[model samples]
Target: MRNEKKKSFYQEFEVFSKRTATSPFQHQFCLLAPNEEVAMVMAQENFMRREPVADIWVVNRKHIRTLHPEEKRMLARIDNKDYRTTKGYGYLRKKWRQYEQKMLDEKEILSWGGDKK
Candidate 1:
């Protein structure tokens, strides 16, 4: 059928881009093309047409290594680590308030940026 032929005309191509000189390559999305030349030619207009793309790469889908469903399940984390976060020190807000001093929350601490004057 015509649909089958058109399907074969466009193989899956993974697109990637670099936003800036020091930025790392990132996966954008996938498209379909018949060959590497077609994939490369189509990569820009198909994915980065309206974005700032410093670079691009079009790879065949079969060349990618992806996590399996079971492997993906291993990425889960437990919810018992509140002690490792600011939420654990939430009482500091009330304590600081009692002292008539503002709580040095995350936004304030990050703004310090090595100069605490």
Candidate 2:
């Protein structure tokens, strides 16, 4: 087997999917295949067999640009803007409790535009 030749056409891919219409797209796993077509076919039978996947995305790893170790060290560290975070806002929840009302959390605010049940 030492003299055997391998096909370079098979590429690494990142697979992401969502289980339902309202569910966010999540990273399921990775796979190696010749192309997107084969990857989709394989993913359907091999990966999504037990889960209800509403969508499928197959992206080649080479096409994705990622930060290098040196780049990470060069980047500046920064604190998150307080307005963009949910922490340090527990006081709002306590205030709502005084009125016997539930607090509108991040999830509740984001679901304002979602279809009603």
Best-performing candidate as measured by lDDT: 1
Candidate No. with top TM-score: 1
Q: How close is candidate 2 to the true structure, as a TM-score?
A: 0.58
Error of 1 at 4 (Å): 2.9
- What lDDT score belongs to each candidate, Candidate 1 first? 0.83, 0.80
Off-target runs (Cα >4 Å) in candidate 2 are 1-4, 78-117
**Residues 7-62, candidate 1, lDDT per residue (tens digit)?**
87778988888988789999988887889998888887676777788888788998
List of clashing residue pairs for candidate 1: 11-33
lDDT of 2: 0.80
Q: What are the C-alpha RMSDs, in order, of all predicted structures?
A: 10.9, 14.3
In model 1, the runs with Cα more than 4 Å from the true position are: 45-52, 99-117
Q: Which ten residues in a row have the lowest lDDT in candidate 2?
A: 1-10
| Per-residue accuracy of model 2 over 1-117 as CA lDDT, tens digit each | 432333476788899899888889888889989888998888888778887888988888899999999998878658666766688686787787765544446557778879877
